[model samples]
Target: MKKVKHGGNIYEIAEKLGIQKEEIIDFSANINPLGVPINFKKALIENIDRIENYPDPEYNGLIQAIAKEHHINREYITVGNGATEVIFSMIASLKPKKSMILAPTFGEYERALMRAGSQVEYFHLKEENDFQVDDDILKTIDESFDLVILCNPNNPTSQMVENKRLIKILKHCEKNHVHLMMDEAFIDFVDEPTKETMLPYIMNYHNLIIVKALTKFYALPGLRIGYGITSNVRLLERVNDHKEPWTINSYAAMAGMVFKDKIYREKSREWITSERKDFFDELKKINKIKVYKPNGNYILFKLLEERKDLREVLLKKKILIRSCSNYKNLDESFYRIAIKDKGLNKLFAKALKEVLYES
Candidate 1:
């Protein structure tokens, strides 16, 4: 098990740069620019005393919020401290001998799969194809693998797997006796989550599992609440049985209440829907980099010409963007940045141009 570097490392970057954390404009983390929901903030203030009690090991309230939001049975939901916790618990319980993942998708999947002693294989998404998972994925999955994990609107690429193609792959995995796990953590920020999600198929396929996170869209990364949904009763039970009790803190448990806060949710949806297009179009005009069309709340770009270490240059300007060098299939020319407020997006664009032409 080799240790791998993870992104959104503003603290480390700030320490090395000798600057205050607040001074950096972090476009590294794909978090909502709206910041934490106002409803969650008020709840935290009013119930600050919640810190005294241990969070319910059962997490009934959290599960109910998720279930009601998705219009699914409460029994199908399993909450975790964050999506990462659920990911680790599920992979550990399944104990698959062989697992498959996307080469440049979120890194944690490989880490979790490897920790469970599974032989990992990658469906190397091609750069020429703009990193989309194509029909070939169905042909690649077979009986040899016991588990397959995919990140829709995949990280570092921000490219979505079409619903039709995803269903075909799901059917392929199901017939092959391979468990399919879809990480829809960023799905809420996608164009049409209702149409794209695999949640609707869970009831029909016991082999299907969907993981979601409140950390990204809800801007509650600090609160650390995430969950996995599956109709596979046996595997769900195994996940619960192996999970550490109280992994979700009291604040995290209450943070789930904000999910149903319609006002905040709508505002977030409107912001992402309207701003992402303009931002993507603007990035396209920059000659210094090649921007990948985004389907999520982040855009992936590659530097052109001689400026390979652009991330280091931007850090000097107190802007933190994710350098994709550590990702399995990415290198120095690549980086990923969050789609933020219009003003911040402009700030990033200006800073990037300045770094390119003036630095």
Candidate 2:
């Protein structure tokens, strides 16, 4: 199968441009701008020797931390290298005969479903409706599909499924005996995540599964820590027994401490809440693009004019924004950008105006 392109490929960009990767202002990846917590870095450094030993296969401590954070049973939790691993493993274990996903959603779901030999279908999000999930999704997901994947506060579009609608879909999936795999990788970046999450329903609905990652919120992508939650203990056991040992390394196991860092968590909330609003408002002032109000840490916009090469133009200025043309339902005129710090956000807005109007 052909590999799907994802953002955060600074190495490739640096090689092509003959400049250091650090020199480029990357808005391509929707990561927390505050970066890795200082306390976590200090702990990692102090315990660097932990890498000499292999990580516990059970990952008891990591699982405990995650379980505590969500107030769920530890038996329901399964850890993986990243959310991507959890996604693939869950699909493999479920081995759905048929699956459905959002047309312009995360590409990995389709790849995983294909790997499991399941026929794939898409629920296209209409751009005219601001790419929100509509009632048509309810009709599309019936007993015919064995598995349905949802990315909350979905990528590229940064639009979330309304809580009421999401609950309705969950009940519908349950009745139809279809497994609902909700990827909450970016949920922590959204406002009122507690209300938006479906964790509370896990115990009541055996058909629901949640995949989450500390990679984006904690800025620890290199550490590769992620997990899945479901009330189906049998399925969790199957995921655990499916294969490799020590997929999560020793250092990654220590990432459990990040969950307890209340100060860092609060500061991140403050930063994202402030930056997303101000930055989006500034971008809206630009007449050349139609900015979609974001519910996540990033924003998606469409070029109003005929600038098909906007990404290329911005790259010349050492700026990197995600080109959404490669997404199944989106076209070349669309792009997604991370909401960064105050200074960087202003720089991007200024550079964008120069690209759209000045040149």
Candidate 3:
């Protein structure tokens, strides 16, 4: 019911700080620190004149690239302005009377459900369990609920649900005639995406809808391109019918080309593999906080002994971290920090120590 403020807000921070947006070291966003792919940069620059033409409403080229990259049928995919757009559109199309979402998950799910006039319920992920989704969720989802949504490597908490457990839940939902939607937006940042992704099983489960984003893994949030995959052709058709024409722009459509940028993809893989380990270890050494073992490119930490305003202190140092207070099951003491380039990550830890220990 309350307004939600999701992160990646450098502009707002910069305005309040009376400085340029670039002055802020934004750890609030979980985007790849390797930045945009070189291929995308070159393509975008070369195709600057693309703005003169309208994007193909069907997004043929983009869809083809995505299908090829994932080795799935193009018809199984529905591209959107961002993963958020796809989420909102999918919920709108499903038009469920009651929907269940993980508490402290992405705020947009609740917002979208509310907008669609659906009664939304929360599956409160317990902090004691490191905020992971467990068997208790099975009890909460029942025939009355028409839809269930989950976020793998969930935001803010940085917790990934086990694949086997998730599959069990999906089967239960299918038997009960419930739609199951899984947001894998941050899954690519995880150490082993192939082992963790549910995308492979989509064809076998028509009720399963998997939402993915190029924003975090490819570092192209500004371009606003993401997509949803489902095997239910009828549902896909319904979603496409309800969407606004040309919601995806020319550059964004062409941006799909970057999905096949093997060099950029491998570089990101290596960066996250090394940095996530080093950064989590460093944060663990700082006893002022309780750091959750990171499986993704971000870490979730809780203040142990400090009552100081963590966000405010970090803001003063031109560093922005995600305050998890807005999430359903989290509180003021909890925060999420992006695993950035080694230099910036070290600087963040140093600044955090000064705030927690020295001053």
Candidate 4:
């Protein structure tokens, strides 16, 4: 399998351009424009001495916080360096013989499946359907597959699997004895996450597993804090036992504090709700591209014009957007951009308009 290219690599772009990293306005990685929360910053500063010792292997406080936030049992929660670790470890433990994933979704699922020696298949999301998961997925998933993966409000595309339709798929997978892994990393940014989340279904279906990250929503990507939730205690134990010790550092363990920052949480909600609307609305005016309505903090668009070198052109202007060419089902014409604060988003819009039309 080939290596998957992820966004947020300002270092490489900076090096190639011989410019400082700070000069680049990145819309490549879908992170919070509000940046790190003030409370978390204070916690990090106060807990700087935490590095002096190893993190509690059990991560009691962290697990408790997460459990409280979701009202799930701590026994069902498993923490990792990031959702990536929990994903790899969970797949490894499951050791599924055959697995299925959505094409043009996050790349790590295939990579992790390959590492576990599972044969991978893709359920291609039709471009004409706005790349949304529909009833067809229920037919695609059956007893033949050992595991099925879904990225709710899927990456790049930023489209969600409707709750009603998702339940139908879940029932089908359950009846077929197929394990379903749902990565809800960006769900927090969506409107009405409570209505859409599958966290409530985990208890009823042992086969259901949810992988989430505090990285994007909490602006703690560098801290590498993520976790998996499932009612399958046995599977959780296996995942914990098979994994390396203390993959989560002391500082990362402090992620539990983020959940308690209600003030910061509300502020973040206000920012994403407002900015996502304004930014997406502005992008819609640019006729050079077809913008997909977004539920996450990022938007995916396709260049209607013939230009395939948009990323390069924008980079010259100190702007960076994710080229979707490397994603399984997407081509060079497709690109994904993070919804940022008003000024930067406007700047990106201007740069993109110039690249698409003026140039």
Candidate 5:
């Protein structure tokens, strides 16, 4: 299996441009602009010696933290190196023979499904509809599919499924005995995260599984900690049976500590609530590209004219944005950029205008 490429690779872009990675402004990865939490950093430094010992094989403390955060039972939770491990492990345990996913959604789902020997199908989201999920998906899913994956506030597009419609899908999947895995990696950044999350549906629907990452919201992508929640004990046991031990490092296991950082959480919500609207409105003013309204911490836009190489041009100015051409439903004209700090976002907007109009 050749590896899949993801955003946030400032190192490679910097190397190619003959500059330090920090010199490049990266809008490629959808991460919290506030950076890692200060309290967590201090804790990490104070307890650096924990690395000398192996992480708890079951990651008890981490699971407890996640449970407390969601007000769920520890029995329903499972941890992994990142969201990908939980996803792959879930698929491996379920061993689905067939699965369905959104066409332009996260790429890792398809890879994991394939690795588990499942035939894959796509629910192609149309660009004309602003890439939103609708009732049409109900017709596409049936007993034929053993699993269905959804990325809430989907990557690249940054559009979320409406709650009523999302529940309908979950219920439909339940009726068909299909496992519905909702990836809530970006849900924390959504305007109404509590209302939009599938976390609440887990206890009532054993078939529903929710996976989340501390990577984006906590700005700890490098730490590699993520988890999954479901009410199905058998499924959790299966995931544990076949999983490798100590997948999370000692530092990553301390992820549970960050959940109680309410100050950081409030500040992050403030940033998204402010930045998302401002960034979307600013991009809308640029007639050269069509910007999609964003619920997550990123914006997806399409170049209006013939400038398919917009990504390349922006790189010359030491700016890196995600090229979404690799996504199934998207084309070369499509791109996704992260919502950074106010100053950096303004600088990006200026650089973009210069490339499109002046240059």
Candidate 6:
């Protein structure tokens, strides 16, 4: 398999452009516009000495916070360095004979599934439907496949599967004895995280496994903290066995404190509510591009004017946008960009319009 390329690599872009990484206005990685929460930063600095000792192998404190937040048993949760670790560990432990993933979804799922030596297949999300998951997916799940992966408010596309439909898929998967791995990494950015999340369903569906990232919502991607939830304790145990001990560092172990930052959470909610709409609307004004309605903090668009050089042209303006050419089912005309703060969002809109509309 060729290596999977992800967004947020400023190092290579900077080197290529002969500019500093900090100088790049990144619209690649879909992370919170708000920087790290103040309380967490303070806690990290105050407890910097904690690094002298190893993190608890069980990560009890971290799991306790997660369980408390979602009102589930700590036994239901498993932590990892990031969602990546949780994903890789879960697939390794499951050792499925075959699996399915959404095409043009997160690249990591295919990588993890392939690493586990599973036969992988793609359920391509239709471009005509704006890459939304339709009832057609229900027809795709069957007893033959042991696993199916879903990225809710899916990456790059930024479209969400309706919870009603998700329940149908969940029931269908359960009946077929297939595991449904739901990646809710960007759920925190959605308008209704509680309503959209499949977290509540994990208790009833042993086949359901939900992977989440605190790094994206809390702007601590550098610290790398994420987790998975499932009702099956045996599955959790297997995942634990696969994961290395103390994979979370001292700084990352402090991630449990982020849930208590309710004020920060509210502020982030407000920002996403206001900015996501404004940013999407701003891009839709350009007749040269077709912008999809976004449920998460990122938006995917296609250049309708036959220009494949948008990424490179935007790079010259010291702006970095995610080119979706490498993603399956997407071509060079497609791009994905993060919803940054107002000024930056406006700057990106202007930059994009100037390039696309230029005679």
The 10-residue segment of model 6 with minimum total lDDT is: 302-311
Clashes of each: 0, 0, 0, 0, 0, 0
Candidate 3 RMSD to the real structure: 1.1
lDDT of 1 by residue, 1-359 (tens): 78767667778888998888889899999999898888779889999898888878898888888888899988888999899999999999999999999989999999898899999999998999999898988888899999999998799799999999989999999999999999999999999999999999999999999999999998888888899999998999999989878988888888668876889889999999988998998889999889999999999999987754888888878888888988988888899999999999999998888888885
- Pairs with backbone N, CA or C atoms under 3 Å apart (clashes), candidate 5: none
TM-score of each: 0.98, 0.99, 0.98, 0.99, 0.99, 0.98
Candidate 1 lDDT for residue 298: 95
The positional error of residue 114 in candidate 4, measured at the CA in angstroms, is 0.4
Q: Whose TM-score is higher: candidate 1's or candidate 4's?
A: 4
Candidate 2: minimum summed lDDT over ten consecutive residues — where? Answer: 303-312
Summarize candidate 3's per-residue lDDT along 43-106 as a digit string, tens digits: 8999989999998989999999999888999999999999999999999999999999998888
Per-residue lDDT of 79 in model 4: 97
Pairs that collide in candidate 4 are: none
Clashing pairs in 2: none
lDDT of 6 by residue, 249-358 (tens): 98887799999999999999999999999999888888888999999989999988775588899998999999999999999999999999999999999988888778
What candidate 4 gets wrong by more than 4 Å, as runs, is none
**lDDT tens string, model 5, 67-185?**
98999999999999889899999999999999999989988988898888899999999888999998999999999989999999898799999999999999999999999999999
**C-alpha lDDT values of all predictions:** 0.90, 0.93, 0.91, 0.92, 0.92, 0.92
lDDT of 2: 0.93
Task: Indicate the worst ten consecutive residues by lDDT in candidate 4.
Answer: 350-359
Can you write out model 4's per-residue Cα lDDT over 66-97, one digit (the tens) per residue?
99999988999999999999999999999999
Cα deviation of 288, candidate 1, in Å: 2.3
